[model samples]
Target: MGRILLFNKPFGVICQFSQDGLHPTLADYIPVPEFYPAGRLDTDSEGLLVLTDDGQLQHRITDPKHKLPKTYWVQVEGVPDSAALDALRAGVLLKDGMTQPAGAALIDTPPGLWPRTPPVRARKAIPTSWLELTIREGKNRQVRRMTAAVGFPTLRLIRYRIGAWTLDGLDQGTWKMNT
Candidate 1:
């Protein structure tokens, strides 16, 4: 086993340790050195990010062949119907290709959820809903693309779990060494 760190990444923060001169980078939140993110979370997304000092462990967490499940708490622009949920479960086709079938279900907004800075855009007329979506593949913007393809574009995306790790006790912009 190697040193493992679980970080609660904030939105608008880049995943890299180096400064980007624009958005805040991981360096701003985590001071630890020599640890690199095992996988990536987009600049617009938030939540659990795993970092490690071990190359083999990073590869295992990131390689698609390992198929570690990633779960997200997604807030979409509109309520998804059964058909939409089924589409997500069956796999949605994207410009890149068909995504692997995913686990999708309607979920109430997670308890103890931290509010996103510059909160998600709200239209009083169009209602929003949350879904717990889990995917085994890590395609670029796959979750957002899948929801958009299903006609309920994602308004907010927060990764809640990755494999056996989760954001349970971690707070936004904080990190902890995995015991």
Candidate 2:
């Protein structure tokens, strides 16, 4: 058992603690010292991020061998039809490799979702839709790539859950020490 901190990371916040001199870093939001992010969420992405003080625990959370499931709420440029959804469920091939089977489904906009500061790009002609996507692997830009492969590019991506931990009750830019 070690110190675990669950943070609702805001979009545009860099995952690292040190200042990048261009964007806000974890240090801006998290004042706690000696804790590091268990895994990375891209600066363009938002939502749940787990941090820990124990090195072994961090390894467990980040190691792909653990197959820890991560879920995201994705807003895409186009409405995903059954075919697109099926493709996501089966596994979509990316430049890196074929992704593992994922859990994908259409979902309404998440309740109580905080609006992104710089808002996602929008088009008056194309209507957007939401999807709940869960994946076991932590490939680089996998979710956005997955949606793009299926012809529905992701406009906004927010990580909702990682393993047993979730973003529930965690507000953007805030963190809490898990008991």
Candidate 3:
């Protein structure tokens, strides 16, 4: 029988089980053996990471051909104007290639948001804003690059959902098993 685990990965934690010397890893939080992450989240990012013992299920979630829509709440260094939002929705050019069109919008602070440790750097002169972005492709540092391409650098990124799964009730560094 296949099993699934939804993990709420905290910021600064590595996704891998191996030790990297300074940062904590999934091994510290998830005690389950043989389960592998369906996808990866950078150490700087925070939110849901789906893990499963089934290879096929992992492929579906991470494979480009499946196009599983992933949603993120991004905090950026500057407020995006309509043109910028349009650019994002229309797909921004990246070093890898032009990204697929994404669902992009400016949003107020996310409700029930947890504060990041050592909170984002603030500048009284430079303003920050939140954006909700959904994309089907997973590229390296894609969200950060996308925001930076449109004149706003990502300050913090939180993956809120992957297809039907969400970070809903999971707190930071917690995991729940789905049998």
Candidate 4:
């Protein structure tokens, strides 16, 4: 069997193995050679990222046709009401087209959450809320667009789990091999 790695990527880290002159890349944290990212997370995003040495495993995880649901914990600009939740659950329209229906629910921020390095802009008038969203499709910036379409813009996006793998014990910029 080939090696598999689960990492809790921190904000500001690029998903690529090598940096293009500037900015930190996965190479700064993941030491495993010949392993490639199974999927991608934006530099501004954080949380679970998978790496694998097996090409087959890589395809299985990255291919949207396989329909492995990705779960995210999102902080948005406003409290989402039932209508907004329903809109998200029912599927929101994007520039690409209508998105697949999603599983979304209001959630409390877990205790002892580490703050983002450069925190989100504070607004005295607008409050924020956390939401858990699970989606089967992988579209570019889909989650951010979806929430905005439903009247709540995402303030922070963190992928907590992917398929059966999670970032449970992993800390920012740390990784562990799954035997």
Best candidate, lDDT: 1
Residue 5 deviation, candidate 1, in Å?
0.2
Misplaced by over 4 Å in model 1 are none
Candidate 4 per-residue lDDT, tens place, 1-179, comes to: 66899988889998898778877899999777899999999989999999999999899899988999999999999899999999999999998899999999999995546789889887999999999999999999999999999999999999988999987887777899976
**Model 1's TM-score against the true structure:** 0.99
Count steric clashes of candidate 3. Answer: 0
Model 2 shows how many backbone clashes? 0
Backbone clash pairs for candidate 4 read none
- Local accuracy of candidate 2 as per-residue lDDT tens digits, 1-179: 77999999999999999888999999999999999999999999999999999999999999999999999999999899999999999999999899998999999999999999898888999999999999999889999999999999999999999999999989899999987
Clashes per candidate, residues 3 or more apart or on different chains: 0, 0, 0, 0
Q: After superposition, how far is residue 169 of candidate 1 from its true place, in Å?
A: 0.4
TM-scores for every predicted model:
0.99, 0.99, 0.97, 0.97
**Relative to the true structure, how large is the alpha-carbon lDDT of every model?**
0.96, 0.95, 0.94, 0.91
lDDT per residue, candidate 3, 77-127, as tens digits?
989999999999999999889999999999999999988996999999999
Cα RMSD for candidates in order: 0.5, 0.6, 1.0, 1.0
Indicate the residue-level lDDT of 73 in model 1.
97
